[model samples]
Target: MPAPTHLLIPYSFRRKGILLGALLGILLTACQPRHEQAAEAATPPVGHYEGSLNAAGQPEVRATLDIRHPSPGHYEAEFTAPGTLSFVADTIVFSNNQLRLIRPARPGQTLALTLEGDFWRGALTLDSTRATTILVKRGVPTPSTYRAEEVPQATGSAWLFTPADTGTPGAALALLPDAETAPTAAIWADALAREGLIVLLLPPTDSATAAAETPRLLAAVRLLRGTAGADTANVGVWATGARAAAVAQLLTTAEAPRVAFLMAHNMAVGPASNAVLRELRRRKLAVLGLYGGTTASQRATALRNALGGRRGGTVLTFRTAGPDLLRPDGGAFGPGLPGAVVEWLQGK
Candidate 1:
């Protein structure tokens, strides 16, 4: 078989053409902007950040930023400057390597940060004042302030949070939610304990009826009353979700303990019924209702209106916190929430 000479180009020429093509491709890639090929704004910088906030006339303030994407299509960010500034951003957005954290409660207040290498550089603007800031990713684990021990009940186990401090607790509160199972339960319990209050964290129940929960509630109250350092006379209940309704129902029954107060956290609706409201009013129990997140104001307003003219019925938004009452990282309580509860209970 004879090969056709016209179809066979010179080997040297073919090699040169291949080399030239690869060189052109390399040049094109190298000339393109680096950002155009990078990942989308580095996945929104989700984690903890700590650094400094600088004001023109004041000393630098240490600050921290916690950013989290708890679920799909939702974001949480909390910024704290110790004694200076603290807020949970009502909305968050990241685009083109820029981050914007905003809270609608404070008009003209916004945190604008730009991603730089391994840190965020920007300014926090409040009204007309803008403070320059820088934040670097850091490990800041949520602190635990109390020791927990499991108390076995006939139905389930509960957790008792005794403050590490030697000082006697001023009051006792039975957290009647899924405190034993919820992810942030320890943080809530410890936060209360940090304020010199003994927290009895009740376990989740399987029964749907308040009748079944009544005995458990009474037992928790009794345990708190018997705790060595707790002020038995000042025992109260802190509740959320359906358990809140159960607590309300229990309060109206003859078997109910004489609870001093009821601290309701982030409830979307008002009391379970008019009967519950009447029971609360008749008992003259101090009600400290804290609402947070997007619907906080509306819920607070509704609760306030529901208790119109009733003394000891205090319902308000909880310092612009998120619904869960925990920071984005689930490490600590939201800004001033535990402190607010302590302050109100102290006054009571």
Candidate 2:
């Protein structure tokens, strides 16, 4: 009466056999080479990269790349060569462990790069020749602790530079640079801060927003007094180019008493400027003028003539250092310029 041997196998034993087989398959897959497993979990490199461009018969250019991945298979890239050229890629592609950034334009160029360890190796092809480029992984630059802040009732922004210890009320300086000179303005702010003055850098604004200049400057002065703990009576206004003219006009208004000192650089003596100087003289404001000997000597002379009989007004001219005294990089000033400004500001 015994059943066939095959029929004697229990259903529970068959289920166990199937489960064991599946586990063995998974274990074998896990034991495969790590390289094979890594291929499935790969991620695109995303971060800041710094490098240089070397071309025949050209100055070496520093380059920085910023790469970002927003979603799967989507990327954004910005390439910058400071003081030379820069562009953002309209299209970015990453596939098969390689990255390609492209933007449609004339004199077409392409960047083909691959990540190798902690660095990226690439070639930038323009026209016919390819330039070898190497970019190392780097962290994004940390923003400066000294930073720009919007004035409560102003049109443009002001960068505030506070000393490490501003124990008591000190003099406040309002720095107004040319429209294209914020970087240089920051440098001047730092230099003045080192001399124990609270520096508020007001960047140039466009004509469309020009009407806000006076109120914005007044608000900045108040901010320096209330927030920065500056002596309102000792505040000064330093401006360049058209900004100087504007500051001159501002002083003619009822708020003239707010600024105790005035320094105007590269401003020409004209009807408008003359009127401003007259008002400043009437107010007994201490005024300092700096001009380039080669480029602004005539203007400087005219200004000196206008201020000849006025007390507390002085004009100095320097050769080779003109309006471009602030380097494009904003990291440096013309030779001896910083010392001169510091000396004048400190009444030395």
Candidate 3:
């Protein structure tokens, strides 16, 4: 049995074929680096993530994140925090095992995170504050049961609480929350809603920002007026602490909308507050001033005197519910405050 003709192929030809195949393999590998291929394979799957924000000296704030990858290297995110605050991040970057999500705006915020296996750890920077946060893949996100519905506004979002008895014309109350009083505002909204008032809870803004957002506040008033059965002629604003001053300024402005009454709690007597008192006096707007007994007695007295027995203005004093009522943690007077507010609104 001598070798077949095909088996008689030259050794050089066989060697050439093997060499060509090896060269092709090398060229294919050179086109895509091994590490890059591994990185592409190691990308974390996009889905829902649940996390908590931990800041020293601050209570833990939990968050839910919905992440989506619509195309290669592009991502979108929606983040919800306490008090049902939600914002969407259209700009997200993921590269080199790091992810960055930003809500780009003046006083913009950012979250820079790194992937470690299945976990993502990061820090959220907002304004001048930074807090540590971590997210892990979640099979399902916890449902939010916040009672108030978030209504977007030009300045920010407002929490709206409409009374069940919306068929009858009733007063529309704009409750402005102080920096630490969002929860209190919710409580107020619920209590006021039960009393047949349509409440629009304004999110807290810093004093400086509040001073500049008069037009936004006016817009919110317009939004509230547009609601069915809302008494546009009897629109009232209730604000406590620093925001009261801002509200006063807003009401006093030439472009300010018509506000029939104002309820201010624990408002300090200063340039802004003084201006507010003067404006209320000039307009003869119904005013209810709630003050803590010890700390604000003088200022409250000054406010009352400024009104000088204006027909619709009244000042109420609380021995225990002074400035602390403006604090988020101070809720001792919550149960009692709402009753007083209801009575005042009814009296109006």
Q: Judged by TM-score, which candidate is best?
A: 1
State the lDDT of candidate 1 residue by residue for 161-188, as single tens digits: 6654535657888886644225455456
Could you give candidate 3's per-residue lDDT for residues 1-348 as a string of tens digits? 111011001110000000011111211101111111112333335778888987678789897677654444333455666531344442455566777665422124667788887678988776566778888888643332112334444345565555535567888878876765553455456556656787777777655344455655665576678665589898888887777776777777786778888888777766546666777787878889887656667777777776665453788776655353432232345336657878878777
Clashes of each: 0, 0, 1
How close to the true structure is residue 212 of candidate 3, measured as C-alpha lDDT?
58
Cα deviation at 266, candidate 3, in Å, is 1.4
Which pairs of residues collide in model 1?
none
Identify the superior model by TM-score, candidate 1 or candidate 3.
Answer: 1
Better of 1 and 3 by lDDT: 1
Q: Judged by lDDT against the true structure, how good is candidate 3? A: 0.59
lDDT of each: 0.62, 0.57, 0.59
Provide the global lDDT of candidate 1 against the true structure. 0.62
lDDT order, best first, reads 1, 3, 2
How close is every model to the real structure, measured as TM-score?
0.55, 0.54, 0.53
Query: Listing every candidate in turn, what is its Cα RMSD in Å to the true structure after a full C-alpha superposition?
Result: 21.3, 21.1, 20.4
lDDT of 2 by residue, 1-348 (tens): 111011101110000000011211211111111111112434557788899866566666777778654443333465655431344443455565677664322125567788887677887765564666788879863222221222211233345555534566667888877764543455566556655677876656664122445765665565567545477778888877777777777777875437788888787688756767887787788888877546667777777777755354888776565464644332235667677877777663
Error of 2 at 195 (Å): 2.3
List pairs with backbone clashes in candidate 3: 292-322
What stretches of model 3 exceed 4 Å from their correct place? 1-147, 153-156, 209-211, 271-276, 309-312, 322-336
Q: Which stretches of candidate 1 lie over 4 Å from their true place?
A: 1-145, 154-156, 165-169, 178-181, 268-272, 309-312, 329-332
